[model samples]
Target: MSKKDSAKATLNDLNGKEWVKATKSWFVVNPKPRSAGQANHPAKYPEELVSRFLRFFTKADAWVLDPFAGVGSTLVAAKELGRNAIGVELNGEYVEIGSRHLEKTKGSGRTYLIMGNAHGTLEHLGEIFKDSIPPFSLLMTSPPYWNMLRKSRGGNDSVQKEREASGFDTYYSDSEEDIGNLDDYAEYIDTIGEIFDRLEPILAKNAYLVIVVQNMRDIDGEMKPIAWDLARRLSKTYALRQEMIWCQDNKRLGCWGYPTTYVSNVHHHHCLILQKR
Candidate 1:
């Protein structure tokens, strides 16, 4: 067979699989507990979760980027999958910790962890990438659930008590620049949207962007539809594609509003998938 025929055959083989398996609206994942290095971050998505998305959206040697790289989970997954990755993290502490994790990953793919605010660092992407920014094939990240961490106070609840005993601060950072510390919900969402807008120029055409977020109750017990609002805002730049619900069934049920009001123990997250238009 000719070389062209071989290439066509390979394409056919890739398309023959049931790619629709990923289209399922929801997934039940039992993520393993965080490793000691990742324990410092209040919120760290499982590397397995990032790996699954990376396999679906990208191929070997393709570029992957994470603007809000908490502990470099995305970068670690990318390297393991043989994809080069760049991560922008705000906290210096997290950058240091995540850098150590990256060094331990045994893979051929390259990884870069930039220690700076995502918003500021985005402007210098080309410089960071050595004079010209490469188009990223995939963007997968989870932002801070706006201000929820700050509101979490140690209580008699076993989970809260355990976290408090561990001496881990509930919030991501004390920095005023941290989006999780923002008190104004509208401003916080707008700020996040703006970051995506800035990223639009750097993203490759038709590339997929996945944002993992969850709705949460505010300090006043009001439900803040963060997931929905962000989707709507980001639709201005990228096409709003489907959403996959990430369900976690392992969490112990907590009686939030016992007999008083209807409050759900939210066990699912909105995995909003967007494509560059």
Candidate 2:
């Protein structure tokens, strides 16, 4: 059933955290600790999002892949729910945290952490699997938004900033490990599309790939429509199914002056879901 068709999602999905929704998105709630972006990476999407995807996309002992594992939220979620998880994180610090969290949380033996870039994973992926890389049942991750300076946006721009300082720039461009340093928007989108296009072969016939992304604010001062465009790009490979809205209740409160009018600060996210044929 569509999110609109169901009664409003109840408080929390088996987990204690309250449900979080974005104004215009689809999917369920996922809550987890923030992964600092500067030292770590900003853990934007909630863990509830991860849990819900796990619930709907895979089953017992299924293999899961998170190409951009950042601090291992997906890995943590996968382990918590009993799925085999393989995570690739660019930052050594994040890999450590993800590793530690999994250890402390009683991770399943199937959980494996790879400290590296998502793109380079192409080479190691085959080796990691050994006897033919098993088709992954589910793939979920949030790609870095453009290399926008997150610190400049904080305090002055947000309702709230989690402990993790990681942002698109911090996660991708700022680090030397980024797959391709294409600053151009179209280039970035195309590169991401290509990455996933290549990823299509490794996924199981009926597997699902879900991405969590929001728009970005540029120096030009206009809202970048990254969300809609990404869907169009990925639609070529995976059947872009729906977008889940992840809204935030807490905020620092601020005003965004309109070039022509007035607008209040906004906080929300889009969780795009895709299923492979």
Candidate 3:
């Protein structure tokens, strides 16, 4: 074999073709049907999404962190991929469900799903992890989109109505600790930045963070550029690397505004990629 082919991959286990394919700026992934426990969470990103990044950013047996791990998607993905994972969730119910999933996960590495606020968990990492915390090579999470879930779109919002009818949570918990519950957009952005800032000590140098977020239209009909805003905010701390667009072609088109306005049915999210500087 040539010297280039014989060389081992340092970033991940992928070969040349796989690595090149993953570098595409945009991709589509129609989520698989969620398990019952997974469906209960309003805003849970798919494990496939997590696995894709995991395969690209880290090699086997690396440590991964998810500050807003809803129902342990990140943990389960990490376990399956042979990576130890630590997830911090604020809701006890979610923690319980996530723990059950983690217990059944058959894999080489360990998984820890802690029930606490993200900031608090970081602050007390030593006590929480029994003083043996691992430096995370990847921090992938889908935080609340600035309380957008809490905003009611009135009678025309069919998705929210269906969630209500099915006894699923329409929004994250009403906990004051959840930054998603904050009313002010500016404050919410700052809190999100602070959480990532707090992760600096534990994140390995050049560790990658994949934050999934979306731009949304507010109730007042103003555009809230959440994805861009967060990128700008966090770039001051972490090195802003690149963004991959996650598109969904399976969602039904909603006629949000009839004849007068041009409200779009958004079916995409921004996966902001950042590196620990």
Candidate 4:
């Protein structure tokens, strides 16, 4: 067979791999407990979860990018799987903590964590990657849940209590530049959209962008469909391929509206899969 035919056959085999075939629309994941450094961040995606997605979406030595690199779980996973990774984070403290975690991991891949707001850091990233800036193979991140952390006070839940004891501010940062601190939902969405818009030029053709997000409830007890809204807006730029629901079965039941009303205990996140058009 010709060299091109041989390559096509290998790609066909990869697409038919067992894990790819088994990937369902919805699945349950019980992530292991976080390490002390990882636990410092209020909202952190587990390394195991990130690893699974990485395996499914990319091969060895592929470049991975995470714009909202909260504690760098994605970078850790990328390193372990032999993928070069670049992460951009707004908080300097988190960049420090994430760099420490990357140092402890055993791997042959390269990981770089940049401390800057993702909205304005594309040029910095281009400088860092220089000739290789336009072809990142995968982008995965979980942005702030839209001011949810800022409203965590006065709750009796163990998780809430633990967060209060962490000494870090309840939300991501006090900087007015942080998107999580924005009270206006529309503005928050627009800002996030703009960030992704700027990121578009950096993504390679057919590369995947996975965003882990959930809808939230406001202080006034109204439902905010953040995941759906993001999907609608970002679909303008990237193709909305599909959603893989990450269901959590380990969360304790909350008495959100015990006797007066009914409220859902949102124990799932939308793993939105978007492919560059």
Q: Give all candidate RMSDs, comma-separated.
A: 2.8, 6.9, 2.3, 2.2
lDDT of 1 by residue, 165-193 (tens): 79875678888889898999999999999
Instruction: Identify the superior model by TM-score, candidate 1 or candidate 3.
Output: 3
- Winner on TM-score (2 vs 4): 4
Residue-level lDDT of model 3, residues 113-138, one tens digit each, is: 98889987666577766667788999
Best-to-worst ranking by TM-score: 3, 4, 1, 2
What lDDT would each prediction earn against the true structure? 0.84, 0.69, 0.89, 0.84
Q: Look at candidate 3 and give me any clashing residue pairs.
A: none
- Candidate 4 C-alpha RMSD relative to the actual structure: 2.2
In model 1, the runs with Cα more than 4 Å from the true position are 1-15, 153-155
On the 0 to 100 scale, the lDDT of residue 141 in model 4 is 93
Each candidate structure's count of clashing pairs: 0, 29, 0, 0
**CA shift at 77, candidate 4, in angstroms?**
0.3
Model 1 worst lDDT window (10 residues): 8-17
The better-scoring model by TM-score among 3 and 4 is 3
Give stretches of model 4 more than 4 Å off: 1-17, 20-22, 166-169
